[model samples]
Target: MDSAVSDAAVGVPPLAEPDEAPQPWQTDRTRAPVATKIVVAGGFGVGKTTLVTAVSEITPLQTEALMTEASEGTDDLTDTPDKTTTTVAMDYGRITLDDDLVLYVFGTPGQQRFWFMWDDLVRGAIGAVVLADTRRLKDCFPALDYFESCGLPYIVAVNHFEGSEQFDPEDVREALSIPAHIPVMIMDARRRISAIETLLALVAHALEETPEE
Candidate 1:
């Protein structure tokens, strides 16, 4: 028998193995999508979790604690009376857009006590979304002031709740004292499409503010 044939018949290993087909989940390094970090910030009960939940393709990581008597006065439940939980830490999720861009969304804890985490959360973030509830406009001031003081590019996304009075984007901008250049959008955090649009706007704004390489 020929040496090569004999070796093959004896189960000798080949010098090189053929490349296997790429798996469905495998992504090409050269063509890999650009991934960016985005912080979703807002006051308590403003639907930060809902927005992240709606936009994320995968199940989001939530750090919620059941509302107890301990927070009765500190955390107001006026508008959201039926609410029974609060984000004690943070909410995290991811979404991909245009098939070439990926966004890692991080939702900050709305309580003042957990605000110490904001510094770490926004460290490498490209921008932020400040969700606002019209009924309690003051609730969002802390988040707005935070991002503003940090000089991070951000947008005002009013999470319009049903039965609440609707305001035009411009009206919201004026009410929030947002700069004219900063985008203010009326979005429904519960709707995936609306949340996606708000994220798209933030991405566009961040790109515009970013210096060209």
Candidate 2:
């Protein structure tokens, strides 16, 4: 019998393996619930789907409806009011940090009309990422209000879209009425690394909020 065939017959070993070990790129890092749940909240046209999908491991789930004049009355047409459709359901995705730790992200509807689902979506989240578009910046208030009322820890990320003017982080914080304690960061969701950095800030905020050292 051939040497390779003999090894395979005994199931002892393979002729050779690749230099790198076979492993999932995204792994569960923490055992138990080390997998934290986080919500991605924002106003319509703020790029919520882009942020989550930018770093999501599995294919992201999105419920986007095409924009039409019917929604003109329902939605608005401003610099961003041109956004027609809205996410009727949440956009869902998951990422694994290691063998035991995983992070689940749910992108909430960006429209104030969907505020009804806020409580249901944020029930067990350790924190939230509120994406904002500076063009029609006021669009983010409803989401901020929802987070404030729910008492859930959260961070705001400026979804810097093309042609949008830059603003100081402090000004955004004040405009949004974000208390000094919360961390407000900036990110361009279309970029994965930027989204990851934004997430790191959120995790840091969550850790800081944990009781007594």
Candidate 3:
């Protein structure tokens, strides 16, 4: 056998590995997509995760944990009987609106106990989506109050659920006592088109509220 062949037979490894190109998010600042952060907030079992999963182009990160007896009194499962898990920390996902614009979505946990994380999640966020369920409209009050107190621009998205009563946007606004200038509309979080439209509405509202430089 030749000396080179003998060396190969002795399990010698290759001298080099091919270089891999950087992903769009990891490229230079000049070429990288401009990132815009947004928060998706709502009460428990209001479909925040579903919206993020449906619209994100990349795989989403979820910190869900199976429901156990530990949450017997703390987490309410009455409206979400079929729900087997809950978001413990937060949910993260990303969507690219265009080659130059990317949106980073952060979903806050619904339970009040987890609300401490909201401050951190909304640090650099341009705006927020307060998803509401007509069946339990009161559940979203905390999210609304927090955003308002923080002076963060946000739009209310009433997620459509089967068998749930449908209300006109004006009616919803009246019920929630949302300001007239704040956008309030219906959205089906599980549908991609609906989710995208909801997000766009929020972005538009945020832009309108921003002071011109």
C-alpha positional error of residue 22 in candidate 3 after TM-score superposition, expressed in Å: 8.9
RMSD of each: 14.0, 10.6, 12.9
Off by over 4 Å in 2: 1-33, 81-84
lDDT for each residue of candidate 3 in 58-134, tens digit (9 for 90 to 100): 67899999999999988887778899999999999877665557788999999999999999999999999999999
TM-score of each: 0.85, 0.81, 0.86
lDDT of 2 by residue, 1-213 (tens): 464464345442231233534234323343354678889998887888888887676678988888776676667656665565668879887765554466789999877678888889888899999898878778888888877887788899998877878888898988878899988777789766677677778888988887886
Task: Provide the overall lDDT of each model, using Cα atoms, as 2-decimal numbers.
Answer: 0.86, 0.77, 0.86
Give the top-scoring candidate (lDDT). 3
Model 2 Cα shift for residue 145 (angstroms):
1.4
* Candidate 2, lDDT over the whole model: 0.77
- Candidate 2 TM-score to native: 0.81
Model 3 residue pairs with clashes:
none
Q: In model 2, what is the error at residue 72, expressed in angstroms?
A: 1.0
Candidate 3 stretches greater than 4 Å from native: 1-29
Q: Tens digits of per-residue lDDT for model 1 on 1-213? A: 464464356443222223644322246656766779999999999999999987776678999899999997899898999899999989998765545667899999999999999999898999999999999999999999998898899999999999899999998888889999899999899876678778889989998888888
What ranking of all candidate models by lDDT puts the best one first? 3, 1, 2
